[model samples]
Target: MPKAVLALGANQGDPARQLALAGAAIAAHPDIEVLAESSVIVTPPWGKTDQAEFHNAALLIETGLSPLDLLDFCLATEAGIGRVRLEKWGPRVIDIDLIAYDRLEMESERLTLPHPYAHQRDFVLTPLREIAPDIADWLVNRIGTSSA
Candidate 1:
């Protein structure tokens, strides 16, 4: 099994409850095993800052699914949670991002391992640091320290 990191966030419609629902969905997946989860934290909106603050958390999991499959699962999970792609960086009901997949590094039309912007976002890094400090440290160091 390969370990992967995921970042979860919601800024609309009961943010905390939305995160809890996402956690449940992830745990319900037969091919995935939840390893650790970070405490949910409130973060000011990023990208498009006009929305409400977001509830954010991170998850560490061991899974039998391939990276692309995991990405698809995330997308499906978001849609299941009522996410609508109305705008880029727009407010969302739930957002699940596959931040990293083992030590793999690759980018295709649908997915990218070691999420290109994870290091630059504190909402992603802070919760990740709580459950997986080493991975968080590596991401920060790997990408020249984060200013967030």
Candidate 2:
């Protein structure tokens, strides 16, 4: 099974509960194994900053699903949690980002491996560093230094 890293966040509704629901959904997936999860942290909004602070966390998983399949699963999970896409970087009930997939790197219409912005966001890096320091280091080395 390939190991992947996921970054999770939510600012609207019950942020903590939203994160917990996402974790539960991921754990329930037959094709995925939850290897590790980081403690949730409150973070100031990134990108569009006018929204409420977000609760962020990270997950390390071993999965049988391909990258695109995992991305699709994440999208489905967000929708299931009441995410509505109304604006770019808008507040949401849940946001599940496929931050990394093994060591694979690729860009498609639907997904990108080793997420394009993983190294730049503390909300993504801090929680990620807690659960998977090796991956966090790899991401910084591969990309650039993080502002965190």
Candidate 3:
């Protein structure tokens, strides 16, 4: 199995509860094992600043699923939790982001490894730094480089 980092956030319908349910759901997946999780933090809205603040955290997991499969898994988890893509960076019941996957790097229509914006978002990097500091380092080192 390969290790990956997932960032979680929620701004509506009891954000804290949403994160708890999401963590449990992810951990319950057959192809995934939750190795570690971070404490959630409150952050102001990012791209879309008109919404409420968000509760953010990250998780380290060991998974047998491939990158795209894992992405699909997260999306399904979000939908199961009543998430809707009403707006970009808008408020939601839950938001799950695959921050990194076993040092793999690639881009496709549906997903991107080492998420294209992970290097620049404090909300993403803060919790991610908690469970996997090395990944935080990789995100920072990629900054200002061609890949970023």
Candidate 4:
């Protein structure tokens, strides 16, 4: 099974509730077994800061599902929670993003893993480091080892 991390967020209509509900839904999926979860954190909107504050959490999952299939599941889960894709980084009922999948890098029109901004965004790195401290350390440790 491939281990994957998903970043969940919501900012409209009971943001926290929406996030929790989506987490449950993702866990219930047949191929997805949620291994760990992070506490919800409230963050000022990132790209679109004008929108409502976001409630964010990260999920660690073990799954047999492929990347595209996992993305489909995420999309379906978002829609199930009344998520509206109105604007990029805008208000949403629930937003589920496949942040990483066992160090896999995938880029396509629909999704990107190890999300493009994963390294740059504190909101993402903080929770990831908290949940997978070893992986976090390995990443940072690699920076200088390349020249060693």
Candidate 5:
């Protein structure tokens, strides 16, 4: 099983419900096995704080899927939950981001493995750090390891 980490967030609708549904959606995939899911962390906002508060959580997953497969899962989850990617960092109904993938490094026009901005954003790092401070610290220390 390839280890992976995902960040789950919601702000538009019932966040708790969205979070649960997102987890369920991920688990619905036969290849994705959830190891441990961190408790939801409610935060103010990131890029656009003017919108709404966000409920965030980190999910440790094990999957046989490739990086691109995981990215497609995330995008599909967002679309399934009615996410409109109109504005940059705007309000969202649901947002699922692949934070890490078994130390994999990938760069594509569609997505970047080990999310480019995972460290700087408190929304991503805080809940992540809570679930895994050591990994979070490493990501912070190794910011320049990738294109970030």
Candidate 6:
């Protein structure tokens, strides 16, 4: 089973509760097993700074699903929790991002592995550091090696 690193956040409608519910739903998915979860951390908005602060956390999961399948699962979880994509980086009820999928690196119209901007966001890094510090190093290495 591949281990996937995921980031979860919410800035609207009881942020902590939203994260909790998202975590539970993700764990209950047949293809995913929650191996570890980080403590939620409070952080300010990212791209859109006008919104309320967000509660963020990271999850390490063991899964049988492929990367795209996992992305679908994350999207489903978001939609199930009433996520609305009204604006870029706008406040949301919930947000689940696939930060990494094992060591796979690829990008398409649908998704990007290792999440393109994860390294640039403290909100994503702090909780992720708690669960998988090595990922930070991996990301650094990837960044160093990438020509783009």
Give the Å shift of residue 50 in candidate 6: 0.8
By TM-score, is 1 or 2 better?
2
Query: What would the TM-score be for candidate 2 when compared with the true structure?
Result: 0.96
**Candidate no. 6 TM-score:** 0.95
Supply the global lDDT for candidate 1: 0.91
Task: Give the lowest summed-lDDT range of ten residues in model 4.
Answer: 139-148
Model 5 poorest 10 in a row by lDDT:
139-148
Give the alpha carbon lDDT tens digit for every residue of 1-148 in model 6.
Answer: 9999999999999998899999999999998999889999998898889889999999999999999999998999999999989998898999999999999989899998878888778887788788888986687668546735
What lDDT score goes with residue 35 in model 4? 88
What's the C-alpha lDDT at position 1 in model 6? 94
* Residue lDDT tens for model 3, 62-104: 9999999999999999999999898788889999999899888
**What are the per-residue Cα lDDT tens digits for candidate 1 across 53-128?**
9999999999999999999999999999999999987899999999988878788998876888888899999999
Name the Cα RMSD for model 1. 2.1
Residues 12-67, candidate 2: write the lDDT tens digits: 98999999999999999999999999999999999999989999999999999999
Tell me the lDDT of model 3 at 56. Answer: 96
Of candidates 6 and 5, the better by TM-score: 6
The sequence of per-residue lDDT tens digits that candidate 4 reaches over residues 14-70 is 988898899899888889999888888888889888877888888888999999899
| Model 6 CA deviation exceeding 4 Å by range | 144-148
Superposed model 4: Cα runs more than 4 Å off: 136-148
After superposing candidate 2, which stretches have Cα over 4 Å from the reference?
145-148
* CA error at residue 30 for candidate 6, angstroms: 1.5
Which 10-residue window in model 6 sums to the lowest lDDT?
A: 139-148
lDDT per model vs. reference: 0.91, 0.93, 0.91, 0.80, 0.85, 0.89
All candidates: CA RMSD (Å): 2.1, 2.2, 1.1, 3.4, 1.6, 1.3
